[model samples]
Target: MKNLSVFSLFLVINISAVFSQNHYGKNGMVASASTYASQAGIEILKAGGNAVDAAIATTFTLAVTWPFAGNIGGGGFMVIHTENGEVTTFDFREKAPFASSKDMFLDKNGKLKSGSNHNTALAIGVPGTVAGLYDAHQKYGLIPWEKLLERAIQLAESGFPLPKSLANDFFQFAEAPEKYPEMQSFIKRDGKVVGFGEDWKQPALAETLKKIQKEGKKGFYEGEIAEALADYIQSQDGIITKEDLAQYEAIERSPIQSTFKGYQLYGMPLPSSGGVTITQMMNMWEQLEETPIIGSVQYYHILAEIMRIAFRDRAKYLGDQDFIEIPELEKLLSDEYATELLEGINFDKAGESTVTEIHSIHEGQETTHLSVMDANGMAVSMTTTLEQGYGVKMQSPDLGFLLNNEMGDFNAVPGKTTNNGQIGTPANTIEAGKRMLSSMSPFIITKNNYPFLVIGSPGGRTIINTVFQTILGTTVYDYPMAQAIEAPKIHHQWLPDRIIYEEYKMAPETLKALEAMGHEIQMRSFLGRLMGIKYNAETEFMEGAADSSSPDGGVAAY
Candidate 1:
């Protein structure tokens, strides 16, 4: 595998450069929401920073340029594959505050409510994103911390023309700033929401970024920024205290990985139901090697059936294992169990959506994903979030940040019966210091013992389905990354009792066939956003794709 040249890397990153037109070539690859963020990473690589360094730089810059989704105010998870073959998953998802209770969202009659009154304040979790990024950089970063943030600061100070997607998102939550006057100025204009193509600036955010760059993670966690965030929350009659801020920190967790065929799959674990569920789906899919050829009707049927089984298991048995025992996951992915479930599939018919009693809800579904691979073969698949977009719609006026609505992740139907028995089980119910369950699965695949593909997506419960389809498309159907991601995607969460399809992508005949099998179908213009990088480890050439749903998305390979 030949190493990529520095000049080649630059050509791939410069958005205005002619070389930008080509999505892939030889050097390295980066796909993110901001061109400036991507360029910052390329710059780091050119200055001798490794893949991890570039990932850190790109991630930090995103926290600024794309504040609506990715932010320093929120935290997330990252799966890093170091040059030396070390694999680690960073857990920076927000943690339940120390003052939280099991029945926080439960009402007077012990019923659950989903509105902002009980959810807005004190219910928010302590953020781990900053500490998580710092931890990754402390061990793997080559460029200085300040240097990594320079691009973000410049982008913030210069003010970017808001992209159409962000403008739309802002309009959807226009009431946010009014609810929290501290944020009224930026989110609203002339007491009204801003329109698309308008100029949006966050000097407060810029100042905050500069402060963090100057003071490091501590600046945000223990200093003025923390004080402001705490004060503002308190002022709002919320529950986050300075003590919560002080106690927050990200944890380094081992990614749950398994081999499929000859490829290795690495993903986040525990609070993240992604990796285990994905592995279970893969196991079920692997069982169909005999009859239904890949890509045939039988193939689609098998894939859909397997996914239904996996998701059924997910909806019931999976949750924040850090808080509950996800005992079924280990057994679910076990070869014997997978084979047993696979045996249950009737080759001639699509199985019932609830063939198995998998109980995992798609929680904390709002997320953004990125995939990067440098010349050194170090790859990263990361998904960051504010839970749902514009999380909680509450802004810490003094801190210049928005908190997450992760509490919405718990089961709202308290005391309902689950296949496992008892819906309001203590395992997944909100508790002080518990991390919300997540479906952000960042995965990497290896072929012939070398990195082949790094993939992930952001769509709450749909994330697992999206990743499953793409992997099967690429490995079984032999589609390229572009084709794999663009292929029609379907999802069947047991509770929904319907197979949802992407609009106009699935064949009409296929739709008829699915319907004939007693499957209800619904269509949507868009689903989750996915990005992937396929490295030809043998030749060292790579190709990457950023989701087309995101107007700001792009793939650059040097």
Candidate 2:
């Protein structure tokens, strides 16, 4: 691995064989779930663009190269650290359309309609990706918007070979191809869907990108594309309108900040629960006497307990700050609150769910993350999503992008509990033009007021815990970036009262120990796909790591 260059590893290794690879560079770095997207960002950096320019380029390129999660019709959050030391956050989360109501997913009998918000047309929300990218670029980008979009447009028009990961996604959704004819048409040839290594083209989507490059935000929100979006949605019995598209705007918000072990952590604020949850968990961990031994039963037990406590608060109080009065954030991150929560924990046993107040359902795990840093000291950590894979399984015929099922993220029926034990709460209840609650946590860490780590992930409700563990692994346990990200993870949300972990990742003895402590253990194939970059100013090198579980993830530098 040391002998091979990062780009060389990207080309020579198969997906299954590339997990251990890490990239290092002296100038700049980009880490993402797709090699193509990472390279796109590196290209911008090499061409004299700043971190924001590279991030925008990478994001657009992902829409073309990694469509399963990357999307122009979705929305997300971005945490930015400027070269001059300014920290800001941008919220481009999707909003409920004007015509949507609190009971939209409830039937005439006043019961929640089963699966109405999963893959149906009615699940679509007003998208904000286009607006968000445009706003970020306009404010901080050095290159022209057209230049940043060139690679994505070219990829869409000329086509690229389908990756195995994307092929598997197509196969998984094969049963519902007819439901998303526009997307199917792009991935199919000779009336049959293409598989891995086959050429996949999207001329229609290229045209959409061209319009965006030419007309800016209006290209997506107010003119031909918006008209097509509204028409197709209405035809499918969805209620989004052209007015909703035109009215959408991505707002810039202050990032939530906290400190642990002399490192300052900055993350997205509500409508996302990630930042607060991570801060609370870290604070609780800091109160401990010493770092728990990694991979030990005590390590898993303590982290799980902390996660349960943070998630309980997340469910009880987290919501869109613009619409609901959230608990005082500063207090939540205070040492007193963390110590108070920590005092209730029993080191030998799992605690009972003390939170009776419920919140909304969890967001889908089908989201994407990217981390970027430039030599000038600008950094970005972003996580974007379309809710579920393929979103609502529908696309606008002419616009040629998948629409987000973000409305499904809302709590459709207050007081209802799902199989996962997630209970609905009024704080996240559906409301016209209101942003839905999110678990997408994009974050950046600074040491002595300088960028130290740029990181984020896509794991729905587990995002907060995944990021928390990764940071702990790096900052407290003294693990390198690659090992920290690839290390086995454990998670426990409060209501479920079960610790879900990767099968075979934990030792049998450790499992027995946790089980003895009354932890109900559940096994899963994986937890989250994390992308991160760590900057060592002393060494003058940037180390980039992609989750071992991600199929196409890679790091690029120049």
Candidate 3:
């Protein structure tokens, strides 16, 4: 069976239609990239859990069901808007081990060592998922911590039905055994292609989850699991150590807040380039005197220019704030300052990009996101990832999990900038214990104390733009959650200076207009996978929208 692409789903969503059918019970709802994980969330919610509890349950399940991105071996960010009016964010992004360096990915000749940054064991970052999720659960979860791991443990032990796409992935391992040697967990003894609907079980993974279920985060970071992770990485010439794993801590940060069209948006700040870049773009958009109607050529042209400027700023100024001071953050995110920056934009012509290097240039659009909202009004939006699909493709023989190549996200060389989108910006230079910069944008929007939307997406650098477009589609154009998610989105990172749009989704006339406006256009089969829940004020319902970009994505709600 062929998967249905969002390009083929063109049903319009008026507010009335959204309220009538898309609405779920006020008790809880979940929108995520995996049906298995989304169902896990609904179960937790029904078991007397809040949104945060459901999110924890969903994340661990995704680690089992959507291994390409979700993982206990990787890390991510979580944003929560509690019903009591508190907004908080957690940064569980992966960090460089103590023995890492700035030139680890560079050769003695000062050139990049091909595949070193992302394809080998050295690319692995210290895992942070356990720490991040545990910290959040400790603070706000309504259910017992071990209970969250039950569904994941059961699936890993008894085996869950493999989706078609995952079967295809296993088949690839069968076809190209040499290229995908690390995929041994899925390798069958008979040497045959794996098919969809087959039971996929992992005894080792079940054991690992049981350990966490018994001992909490320590099961992963301090004892047997830690020893296995460190020993395996070291055997592959990697730098992780037990000390690195033990010292890792997830940090709680203040959520970045901004206003657009009278609605307030709360997003993850700093290490994540998502919040700041999106803030800058939105500020510039609000300042534009010639704001065109949605889907117009003028609309795309202006937004691209805005995206270009914001991304250029991202390259030069954004990073782990703990490592460097971003004195420009306050000014840059200010709407008053945006009015000053827009003075240079011609608006009629596309702007040329001057920034040539990017801290996160190597990241691809391979990550997973989950959005959960409970009856109590707690909304959790989370985005987690490895640098690319299957991460470094290094799965531990004992752990049954794939590790992240997040080190590729840091600047690999000092004082080096490239024409092909590599950069050695000081803010993102590799440093022991420093986190790599990211584009994970998990956000919550509110209108006068009412939670309006719990939203987030995963598309590497395109994530920021995807979030921006989703908000525009919903708030500005009044599209329902699904219609907004399926609508075409565009991305422009200053360097590369090209508009990336979903292939064939744009009108011929719109593309021509953008090209004539001095914009260079490129086509991508898809832009992002977004999981969001829109709050219906009139009906008091939560409308969950799971992106159709992935075949197995679903909204598990009541």
Candidate 4:
């Protein structure tokens, strides 16, 4: 059967129709890429599920009902803080198959294959997303698993118009139909990509959801689903065997903790570069009350310099702890190290350094981030992905979930540059069962003994910069939840040292000044999505906000 392309579906979302479905006025907020997905979660909360339950429902629903960025076949990182003060980090990151080896993409001549030419089947890591969701439900979900999935299944079966955000993504990905044939059928109509307001549905995906509801995770890993996944991977020349799916498991790990201005911050540890990089940046800025004041060139310059130094360490030391040494990370984020790095910053000029050299310059690794908080105080900050837009652009008929190309995130050549413009580093090379280093940084801030802020973002290397700016927006600039999330953002990722500023809000004169001082300026089509909640412990009141640019952005309170 020929797969449909975005051009052929002629699909487009009717914004008015989607928005008219429901409202999230108060009590428990859900943020996703689309309104249907958010509504799916809000309905769960209305039906008596707690925040964790709502989040669980929303995640699964997004997997089947929204296919651009998430699915059961992908992997993700989640940070959960319970109402009673228990904090746990779930590392459901994808893992390499046992057959994988370092430099798997390198030829006998010692040349690396182009990023586009890398093996798809060989890059499929053992997916832990479904198992991780199940684990979260078992530990914290108040509703029955089947009940939660039912909502998603209903949405998948009945079908809905593609949301404007998803419609935009479909057109954006239409250029490379061969790489992402899975998106073809959904986005195409008359052999062309569909425009906005068109209807879209995945009946096969709906059936897969029903199977999961009836047979639990086994429906995905053991019976028909498992066989389908194996066959699909085999057809694609992928390395994922049935044993990989059956043996996959999600693990709970302790979050890395740090204190900034009396607020305790918790985030995922190594393998997730977010925790360390964020800690380092925060520590550098902790003493900046007298320094980077908002709207000042000195402040922005100082922060950019700090980002340069921290990113230098990030590229070298951050990786899966099981496969590498991460002991230095904790010590590196200490006050002493921060002081040493901060002292080197010059308010008058940019600092020159070698912080942008990553093992893989695989550009544009997109993901989705969501934040949930209910009246019970159960909070979850999660970021999940199919790698880039649909995981290798492949779909399995039996499983009905898009497989991730996460292995493509690593260096194909362990010690040399491949056709891509990157110098190979072994720390991030492929290895059997080893997790890839991820930039997903789901995090929370605590005031006193309770959670004060739950926040995260969805950019690859820009993750650290986006998160850093949001923290500054809330803590330094004293912006409310909405203002903090919507504030104009600026980012410098160490490589180009050129500052990329969001248009309209940033001062043009400031941009010119930075450009004169050796900053490269680039414009992004859209700002990264950031969602979070802020708690005022003194008053016992909570406020939440979602990224304004995202159509599904919203905050709820009771």
Q: Estimated TM-score per prediction?
A: 0.90, 0.95, 0.95, 0.89
In model 2, which range of ten residues has the least summed lDDT?
A: 1-10
Candidate 1 overall lDDT versus native? 0.72
TM-score of 3: 0.95
lDDT per residue as tens, model 2, 465-536: 889898987788766678778777888888667899876466566677778889999998888899999888
Q: Which runs of model 1 end up more than 4 angstroms from their true locations?
A: 1-22, 116-119, 171-183, 188-195, 291-296, 353-365, 417-423
User: 54 in model 4: Cα distance from truth in Å?
Assistant: 1.2
Off by over 4 Å in 3: 1-23, 187-193, 355-360
C-alpha lDDT of all candidate models, in order: 0.72, 0.85, 0.84, 0.72
Winner on lDDT between 2 and 4 is 2
> Clash number for every model?
14, 0, 1, 26
Give the TM-score comparing model 1 with the true structure, all chains together: 0.90
The ten-residue window of minimal lDDT in model 3 covers 1-10
Predicted candidate 4 versus true structure: per-residue lDDT over 1-558, tens digit per residue: 011211121121122123222223346777665556667788888889887787778788778656767688888888888989888988889888877888677677877665532336676777878778888888888888898888788777776677777778788769777766666765665677766777665677888888888877788878888888887888877778888888877889999889888888898887888888889999988866474445555555666777777776776666788897667876787999888887887767777755335422463456777777776767888888777766676776544567777887776666664323354566677778898888888888877767677788777767768888888777766666666666656776665555666655455555666666666677775457776777665566666666655565554344
Runs in model 2 deviating more than 4 A are 1-18, 175-183, 354-360
